[model samples]
Target: MDGKKAKQEIVTGGQFTIPGTEVRKMRSRKGDRVYQIFVSSPLEEPPSSGFPVIYLLDGNSVFGTMAEALRVQSRRPEKTGVVPAVIVGIGYPTDQPFSAVRHCDFTLPLPESELPVHPKGAAWPEHGGAEEFLSFIEEELKPEVERDYRIDTGRQTIFGHSLGGLFVLQVLLTRPELFQTYIAGSPSIHWNKRFIQEEAERFAVRLRDAELDVSVLLAAGEIEKSHKSRIPEHAKVLFSVLSELESKGVRAEYREFEGEGHISVLPVLISRALRFALNPGGPHTSFSSV
Candidate 1:
């Protein structure tokens, strides 16, 4: 073949997608916003009890990485301890890796006077729709997914990163029973004057009075501490509180990814998060560069 033709063929590309994945759009009854849902099902028949399900945030960015990882790792479950699962990515109807709408969907309500001022003095995007967003998921999305797939509701997991991570903590504190496991990566705990910490305290009180079975994995990049990001310390403190709840049927663990940064830590976190969700008996604390 001619050099030009060969190079052209080498660079040719088409739309890429995970084999068992499908996309659908649904407008939330709680709001005017429409969400793009990505679902990836394992090709193998599910266990008699049904496949575990993971609800992932920022779907446009990480859905493929996670869905494919589950496909490959679950193949050798005896070695990897990773089981096949149905992944549901909740994202906006946009091509962008993350949508501006997340500022609303991922944050909790705060008085206008208490809102943080933008670093550049720009007006912040609309926010404080987390309650509505959570309702949409519990009331609308979960039911839709259950109708279409055989999922073990008792094994559901929800994962989020950054602002999305903040949302995960909110759900865990206020609605711990909604999902069996919660994974928060480099959570933005510094937001809103560290309001989530207070929520954690409240959750502690509730835990004393209620019997709930749940697990949480809090992870952050080691570089975040060197960069003066509050995530590492915040996560550590949250870890301490959660760890004390082991006797209460709460399984909590923490991980710090070596030689990684805020954005770069995602891929490694995804792998570890999957293992943590599927294998609840893994180590409680660890460090890794992979």
Candidate 2:
């Protein structure tokens, strides 16, 4: 090929964006670390009240699909009963999942001994900074988002999967009020040898007396790998704990999608999470009203 033709055909992978959507990327400083923050919100103006926002983890992998799903389902809420939302995807400035930094970002503070060990003992990256990431969202990203768009602070939701899913449970246990709704899809509760179970026990104790209101939805694939992964058993334990919360007046639900594994369940997971979190609790809440 001629030099000119070759140059013209060269494709540059720049910032990805879709029409009628805005991308917000920034690096905010905290001590010695400058964390990159990314957000994507619909171009459509929010309702008179404000836009509900869903903060997604692993944005590099799920942001485009989630945002597009939000756009389509919300376009005709009268039919789909899906409400519009500000889709805020929180991810680093990398295309790769499980990057070195996220190893530090999305995990709980635990020693190496707590790490889940396989029969062959697969090595995992360094962990134990999920609290810092939570602060980044609460103290930094939340404020940044509010400054740019009209948002319903009371309707904030956070969704996470896998290790990110572990972070979601941490958020619910440690700071339930940060978001009114929390969704953990195939969360890695087996991490740190079930550290989250201890946290959930504490949370249940607190909920016995606390008047706080929060909604939690935990979804797992019914056919999730059993031989090599703890996802199915871990999810069952979490689901049972969430049922305890549900009985205690906190709105909670769990479902196992048939014939789906960890990754294949997302399409149903994200859309169902929207309905769970965004239910306005009106007479027209269900599809029957459509």
Candidate 3:
């Protein structure tokens, strides 16, 4: 092909957007940071109870994957058991898949003295805004989304990965009633000196005193090497705690994706997370490496 013809062909297309999706920007009341929200609703008519909704973190990265998955799978609900749902992706306004500013929004508050030093002696990014971020989602984002769509309030879900996954756990533990389902993929259980482990333990104690009608899916990659020794162990510990609480109305499962590393596990987890979130009545299996 001629150089001119090839260049023209490559540049012919306009920007691409997922079907049935809308993008909007809203500033958070809890902070000055503005978030780019991506919303995708199924083309089909909603169920009488309204559509279940999934709120995803790292929107720029996984919004298309999850949105398209639902679009295609929900067409064969009888066979796939995947129901149509609204997807809301919470992300920063950026062309990149993930924003460095996520560090501030996804981490829990930690005293400066308790913050861990960087392994290479470099400085860490601003962090510890998870509380405010949660407030923004609950007070601002959820209300706006509800006003725009008919949402099945009882079937709300929250999903996250890495640091975002840590924030998901924070919401589940501190405000278990906020979301009916929580999908945490490759959560940074080791963050802040394994502070989430302590939080899990505390949640377990709380579970003993009160029943929680919630479902959780915790997953990680089989070959994740950063915290190889501790991630799975911590995941299993938390899984065990949740599994024992089945009588208390908690359904939990843990899965390790085979032949995958940290980042590679995301797409695989996205598909499984959809199934788990939409079919909450399915059997809850214990720790398994798939």
Candidate 4:
């Protein structure tokens, strides 16, 4: 090959994709705003009725990891104790993190006075799109995916981590019936002076007024307490309150990964998250691996 061609090949390595999975980019417009959306779905055929679907946040990061996890575990379903399911990761189009858009999509709009101390940065991105994003999922994306594949709507699950994990809790608190199960990995519970506690109170009222059967799996690293983020302290409080929600008909439980902290815990927690999501009522208890 020519020198220029060889250099180009080196710079742009061949594209890689997950086997037996479909990847696509889409645009959603409601009002004057348009958000780039990424979706990854397994191409495998479903059972007689349909496949249970998992809607995970940060598609760019977790979709492949989880799709692969489900694929591997389902190979020996009996041995691994996991069932087949579909994974749908919601993400933006750019190779870079969609910081501004995600901030808007994943958080609540609290007044500056109510919010916690601002982080060490100038020009924060526009945030407080939590409810709007939920509407998009309920009204737009869910229907779109259902039209393409036979999904078990009754068995829907959602997973998120970090800020995304905060979003998972938002949905669980606001609309528990939307998804059958939720996996929250190291959620950002410390956000904005901990408004999640108020939200949890609202969840109790919603539970009394509505019959919502939801299962939540909470996972956090043991070291989060002492980390620079100091998030484990907040996360433990979040886990405790979520666990109390069980009395109100929500099946809330938690698993702590030893020796794992913050960023390093996702991979360790994902496999168990998938297994728990597939079999929410199963007696399987804890995950010891770090």
Candidate 5:
């Protein structure tokens, strides 16, 4: 191969190989495109001890932090007694992290006034196709993962942050029964004229009879704000919506980090979020891994 081609290939497959974690690739219905999935095993000796899996969007950015946290949490099963489950990080192909495809897959429809042109260039078309993208997860991606992995299909959680967080909210509203838990961190509620607010309210009202046993955790940095403003209103909105849902008997929790900002809250909340989602009965309890 030419030197230029060799350089591209080298950069394409450069994921860190962890001992306990297994990485594999699967092709979607789209013939040539492939998706990489990473899975980690529990630290315990017995193998049949199936685990609850956490699926995180923007896997490239968050998986390492979560996998490490899971490893640490596994050492002391007493604290986390529920077996340490697998975490799946879903991301784009190596060549396409910044491609226009992510916006299409991650975002819901936005009003023309609120739309941001693709960073690639104004000429590049922006996509508003989250519904189909989510269908891919529901029909293709998830079924393959469940078929291959020894995970507890009943206790899965989907986690997303920022734009990804908005998708999490969408899924919870539309397909509330798919997962037992839904977590949104620093969700971008400003999209589509704050459409998520109305969407959430509709879900609460429509699903009044379901009264889901599912848990929803909304968290944001205490300092989340735009440069034009200093106070973070995202957390407040998250709290208000979840609080409203809670009053209706829908399980929910909201938390704020005193000093964290948008870019810094994900890692800080990883452990706290999992513990709360996994163990909701204890209104007062602290998590300290073995």
Candidate 6:
């Protein structure tokens, strides 16, 4: 609507099949530098009404999958019984470096680890910019959606995986008002050796007086531990942390699939996680903790 007709393209990736949503490429200036911005929305129905929205991080990997699940799940409301919502896939344009982008976008603080063999090697050191990333979502992206689409402004949810899951948790704790439900799968709680453990503690104390009614669903697979590493152990500790939150009037649920693995659990469990996360009744015993 401004300088030039910003170029748009049709792309397919992530957790959904967004047939009508066209991808628009834009740029954002963070301080002094510019970063490419890519967003997908329904082309035919810009202002889609009665649809809640799901803002998915890592839209390239998980957006289409989640969209497909919502498509199927929306048809059989009797099965999941959850309302279908619009899927906003946030992606990076070709210009930005993927690792640095995610590293700075999803993390909270630069973590210093005592161990040497960390997953994040030395060169790509940008970390802990989640607050800024959330700001981009609330200020830049959400406003665009609201101006162009018919979205249910009040009912929003966020879904993420691994590091993205860590970002979701950070947003929940720091800005619980942004979304009503939170979904995280196989999150890397081992970040900075469970830095989120301490963040969760602060969130619990703040939530007591705030009375923030938020729902969270944490999911990991039974075989996540079989890799002969510390991931499974981290998941256990993450579960304990979430359980502690539940005891503090924060609605939470935990699910560990019997045979699912880390890489495969997203597709396997996203539907159920979405159901429980968005369910208005808050956390319930519909599924077993073990």
TM-score winner among the candidates?
A: 1
Candidate 4 has what TM-score?
0.85
For candidate 1, write residues 142-205 as lDDT tens digits.
Answer: 9999999999998999999989898999999888989999999999887754587788888888
lDDT of each: 0.88, 0.76, 0.85, 0.75, 0.69, 0.67
- Of candidate 3, the 10-residue stretch with the lowest lDDT total is 281-290
lDDT of 5 by residue, 78-133 (tens): 57633467788887666443344666677776667676444456653565778867
What tens digits encode model 6's per-residue C-alpha lDDT throughout 157-223? 8888777887887787667888977888887666654456777777767756657667787778888
Question: What TM-score goes with each of the models?
Answer: 0.91, 0.86, 0.90, 0.85, 0.80, 0.77
**Order of quality (lDDT):** 1, 3, 2, 4, 5, 6
Candidate 3, after superposition: displacement of residue 101 in Å?
1.3
In the range 112-145, model 2's lDDT, one tens digit per residue, is 7666675566777667777777878888888988
Candidate 4: where is the Cα deviation over 4 Å?
1-13, 31-44, 208-210, 280-290
Question: Lowest-lDDT window of 10 residues in candidate 4?
Answer: 281-290
Give the alpha carbon lDDT tens digit for every residue of 100-157 in model 3: 8899999987887776656678877999899889989999999999999989998999
C-alpha RMSD in Å of predicted model 5 compared with the true structure:
7.7
RMSD of 3: 4.2
Worst 10 contiguous positions by lDDT, candidate 6? 31-40
Per-residue lDDT for 91 in model 2?
68
| Alpha-carbon lDDT of model 3 | 0.85
Q: Candidate 5's error at 39, in angstroms?
A: 1.9
TM-score of 6: 0.77
Worst window of 10 by summed lDDT in candidate 1: 281-290
Candidate achieving higher lDDT, 4 or 6:
4
